[model samples]
Target: MMGLSYFWIDGGTYLGFIVCITLLMFILIMRSFDLKLRRKFTRVAMAMIIALAAGALELGLLAKGDTSTLIYAALLLKYILEGYMEIAVIRIVGRDYKKIQSKLLWIPFIVISILICTAPVNPSVFYFDSTLGLFVRGSLGYSIFIEAGFYLLVGLCICVKKWFTGYQRDALIILFMLAVVSTGVLLEEAYIFDNCTLTSSSIGVLFVYVYMYAERYNVDSVSMCYKRRCFYSDAAKYAKQEMAIISMDLNDLKYINDNYGHQAGDVALLTFAEVCRSVKTNKFILYRTGGDEFMILGIKSSQKEAENLISIIKEKLKETPYTCSFGLHMYKPGEDFEEAVVKADKAMYDDKHIYKSNKNKQANKRDDRFDEKVQSFSNDIDFFDEGE
Candidate 1:
C-alpha cells in the first residue's frame, strides 16, 4: 500500500483536487475560444490552481496526523502565488504586449517557481513530520518570515510599476491595499506575535472577478468614437442646444479605389478622418456614420464663424492630394435633429456636383491645350520636311 498520510485521502483533499481540476478545465476552454480572452483569464486560472493545491496539501497533512509544518508551508505558498497571479492578471490586461516583454518582468516569478518546486525542505512537509517537533517549529517560523518578506517585495514592485505607468485607478488601488494587508498578516504569523488578521485578498479576488465579467459583456458594441447608443442618449438630453450638423463625403473615392486598389481607398478615408478630427473644434462631436460619409454635431455660433471654419478646412484640403465635399445646416432650438441631418446631406450632394463641374472644366481646359500643342508640332514637322 502507498504510504498514506492521515490527510492524503481526507474529504478536504478530495474537494480541493476537484476544484483545482475544474478551474484548470475552465481556463483551457476559455483559451480555445479567443486569444485575447484567454490572455485575460489565464492568471485567474493559475491562481485558483495554486490555491486548490495548497488546500489539498493541508488536508493531506491533517489526514496523515502531521499537520503543523505542512499547513504553514501550504498557506505561505498559497498567499504568495495568489499575490503574483493577481498582479500578473492586472498587468496582462492593462498593458500592451510590448510593455509585457520589455523589462523581462517574468524572470523573478520563474525563479520563485523553481525554488518552490525544488526546495529540499518544504516547510509544509517538515511541519507535518512527527519525529522532528523542534525542527518543524523553527522551519515554520523561518519559512513564514521569508514568505512575508517576499510578499512585501512583490507589493513594492507593484507600487513602482503603477507609479511609473500612472495607473492609479480603482482596481489597482484596491489590489495595492490587499497586498499590504497580506504582507502584514504573513509577518504576524511568522513572528508568532498575535493572531493573524484576515487579509482582504480573498474579497478583492471576488471583486476582480466581478469587474472582469462586467467589462467583457456589459458595454455597448458600437465603434470607439461616438457610439450609436450614446448618440441617442445625448440627443435626448441636449435637445435644446442650437445644433449644427455637417455631413461630408470623399470626392472620387470610387474612382480612386478602382484605379489604386481598396488599400489606397482605406488610406484616403483614414487621412480624411484625421483631417476632420483636426479641423473639428473641441465643441463638435464627430461620427463616421457610414462608409465614405461622416457627421459632425456642434452648438451653432454665428453663420460667419461656421463659414470661416469651413473656409479654413477648404484651404487645408487645397494642400492635400484628394478633396471631400461638405454640407452644413444649423438647427433652430426645438427643431428635429434628423431633419437637420437630411438637410446637411442634401447640401453635401449639391457641393459634390459643384466640385465635379469645376473638375470637368479644368480637365477640358487641359485637353484644349494638348490639342493646340499637337497642331503646332504637326506644322513644324511639315515645314522641316519641305525644307529638306
Candidate 2:
C-alpha cells in the first residue's frame, strides 16, 4: 500500500476545516449582510466540506491493490461531487445565478453529472483496469476536461469583466489561484499527480472568501455607491428617527447614453456617486437607489439641514460638467421612510422635467435671436445698396 504521506490528506483536511470554520464565523458575524453575499459564503463553505470527503475517497481510489466495486463507485461519486462544486464556484464568480446567462451556463453541468453516473457501466469517462489493476479511461475520457475547462473559462471571463470597482486586485489574485487549480486538475487527468485538485481548490476558495470578507460593503459595482440592499437595512435600523431624504436623479442620462455610449452613462453615474460620497458629513448617507437615481438620507432633525446639503450637492455638481436634479423631503417623526422617499422621487422628476423644458426654451430663444440679427443685417445691407 502507498504511504499516507504521499496523499497529502492531512493537509487537505486541515485546509477544509479552516475554510469551514472561517465561513461559519463570517456567516454568524455578517447576519446583517445581504442574503446574497451570505448565501455565497455558505455555498463555498459547503463545497469545501464535500471536497474534503472527495479527497478522502480519492485516497481509496489510489489504494495499491485490485480495484473493487466499492472503490469504483467511490470514484463515480467523487466525479458527481466535483461537478456540483464546479457549479458552486461558477455561481460565486458570476454572483447572479438567477440571471438567464448564469442559468444557461450552469444548467449544462447537470449533464456532466448524468454522464458521470453512467461512468461505471460505459466507462467512457473512467473505469477500473482489471488487467493493469488501476483506473483507466475510455475513448470519451476527455469529457471531464470539456466540463471543467468550459466553466473555468466562463468564470474567468466573469471575473475579468468585473475587474474594476474594487475587484481588480482580487480578480488577478483569483485568476492566479484558479490557474493553479486548473493545472493541478490537468496533472491528475494525465495520471501524473494525486490529491492536487482538492488541495489547490481549497486554497483558491479560501483566498476568495478572505478577499470578499475584507470588502463586504454591499457596494454597487458600477457606481461604487452603497447598494439598494443596504438602503432597506439602514432604513429599518433608523426607522424611528426624524430624517430628511434627498432624491437625486441624473438629467438627460438616457440622452447621454444614447448619444455618447453606455460607458459614458456609467461615467456620469460614477461622477454623481463621487460627488455625493465626497460631500463632508457623517449625518448624511448616500445610496445609488436606482439607475440614474440617488438618495442622501440625512439623520439630523432639521429639514433646512437637508436643504443645505442639497444646495452643497448642487454647487459641487456645477463644478463638474454633468447635470442632475434633486428632490428634498423632510420626514415627520413616525412617518414611513418609503413614503418620504416617494415624495422626494416625485419632486425630483418634477424638477427634472422643468429643467429640461427650460433648457429647450433657452435654445429656442437663442435661435430666435440669431434669426432676428440676421434679418436686421440683411435689411441694412439692402438699404445701403439701394442708397448707393
> Per-model C-alpha lDDT, please?
0.54, 0.68
Cα lDDT tens digits, model 1, 1-388, are 4244433334333443454455445556544334544544555555655665665555555545554645667755764575466445445433422344334555555555545543336554334455542224333334433544554565555555543432234337546555645764665457442212222333334445445444444222221134344455655666887766778787766866776666556656655655555565656665666667766666655566666667777777654555789898987778887887789999999999998888788987844653354233211111111110
**Model 2 spans > 4 angstroms off:** 1-10, 61-66, 96-101, 130-132, 164-167, 190-193, 218-388
Q: What is the C-alpha RMSD of each candidate to the true structure, in Å?
A: 14.9, 16.9
Q: Model 1 segments beyond 4 Å from truth?
A: 1-223, 227-230, 251-283, 299-323, 354-388
Q: TM-scores of the models, in the given order?
A: 0.46, 0.55
Task: Looking at model 1, report the run of 10 residues with the lowest lDDT sum.
Answer: 379-388
Task: Report the C-alpha displacement of residue 136, candidate 1, in angstroms.
Answer: 17
C-alpha displacement of 9 in model 1, angstroms?
18
Provide the lowest-lDDT 10-residue window in model 2.
379-388
Q: How far is candidate 1 from the true structure (C-alpha RMSD, Å)?
A: 14.9
